[model samples]
Target: MTAAAVACTGLAYAFGDTRAVDGLDLTVAEGEVFGLLGPNGAGKTTAIRCITTLLPVPSGMVAVFGQDAAGDRMAVRRLLGYVPQQLSADQNLTGRENVALFARVFDVPRRERAERVAQALGAVDLTDAADRLAGTYSGGMVRRLELAQALVSAPRLLILDEPTIGLDPIARTSVWEHITAVREATGMTVLVTTHYMDEADQYCDRVALMHRGRIRALGTPTELRKGLGTRRGAAPTDPLPSLEDVFRDVAGSGLDDSSGDFRDVRSTRRTAQRVG
Candidate 1:
């Protein structure tokens, strides 16, 4: 069998007394799109941070393409490209310059940096606005610029944390189209976290629904929907359950106090306002 592109066993993380991620076990095969989903503060972002080696935890294990995220951070980093929930592109820099910075940071051979940066920008259809400062771009353009920055390294695994939080539906569709195009062309594994159930159903090969720092359910979208319908004792002739229905069933409603706190709400709102 082929080694998984990403693997996490009993992965746990804490912030002081608060345990963000608790004993997560996950795997993503190479060349597939996997969704890690949950309501706010469900440990999805923290888990992604741990997987990306941004945060250090005392227990559990995380690996990227068979490389230990803890023991071999650099090796794991080399194989991954990450876009965080918060903004990453510098507002003062042009779209092209933003991608160039990533190429430099990733040490993409100085000689090929120019071509690689251009390719990354073009991949996201940002070539025309490449010279414009990121601050001046629309929310969708900014998100695409960030995507280009992540692509500058040509990673084997792309991890995105709410990559399209504030965009309109059309913008969201455009972003996903670019992502799908890249995945098709490069066969890179994509692990993404999003609140958009429709996007997950449309793009993810598999999804893990998390709540209270654990996976409540995991399966293909159709399977999960059907499973929920069955659990609700729906007859075969009943309409299928929506992914949102499954989300509520697993997470105990987005209003569940355990889902998130005021700070989480503030942060998500702030991000939305910025990108809106």
Candidate 2:
């Protein structure tokens, strides 16, 4: 059988005295769009950082396509493409130049580099804006450019963190459309974290709601909503709970304390303002 695209067992991490992640276990199947949903301070980013080998796995195991993340960092990195919540595109770089940079960083052969860069740009429908400086692009276009950067590597597993934090509805829709189209074409597995319940409900094949460094609920959008309704003894004729309702059920109204620290808030707001 083909190995799972991503697997984590007994995963744990912390900052100083704070526990960011606690004995986590998760597995994502190949070619599915998986969402890691959580409010701030839920440890979603920390978990993704560990899986992408950006942070040392202080404890537990993380694997990508069956390879151990701790023991084989380079091998794992080769299989993954990541877009952090923070903006990664350089405002000074032309869209084409930005993509080319990633192609080189991912070590695409010199002979194939130009073509790969072009393809990645085209994939996000940025071909016309390819030569324009990224600073001039609109918020949506900038996000798409970042997606192109991640795709230049041709990774099997794509990880995105809060990909559309600060955008108009139209721009948000455009980003998800491109992501869905790319995934359909390449069969790449996508793992994303987002506070946007609507995005998760519409785009993710399955979602895991996390709180306090642990998974509180996991299932398809339909399943989770229906399950919540059932558990609460809602009448069969009652309206089903929305994903947001489920999120609130898990995280509660008391998010300020559990939400990530000041740095996280600052970074997220900065990204939003820039992208907005």
Using TM-score as the measure, the top candidate is 2
User: Each model's TM-score, in the order given?
Assistant: 0.96, 0.98
Cα shift from native, residue 84, model 2 (Å): 0.5
True-structure RMSD, every candidate = 1.4, 1.0
Judged by whole-model lDDT over C-alpha atoms, candidate 1 comes out at 0.90
Best by lDDT: 2
Candidate 1 residues lying further than 4 Å off, grouped into runs, are 256-265
lDDT of each: 0.90, 0.93
Which lDDT tens digits does candidate 1 get at residues 168-266?
999999999999999999999999999999999999999999877788899999999999999999999999999989998998755555444566567
Question: lDDT of model 1 at residue 263?
Answer: 67
| Alpha-carbon RMSD, candidate 2 | 1.0
Error of 2 at 53 (Å): 0.7
Model 2, runs deviating above 4 Å: 254-259
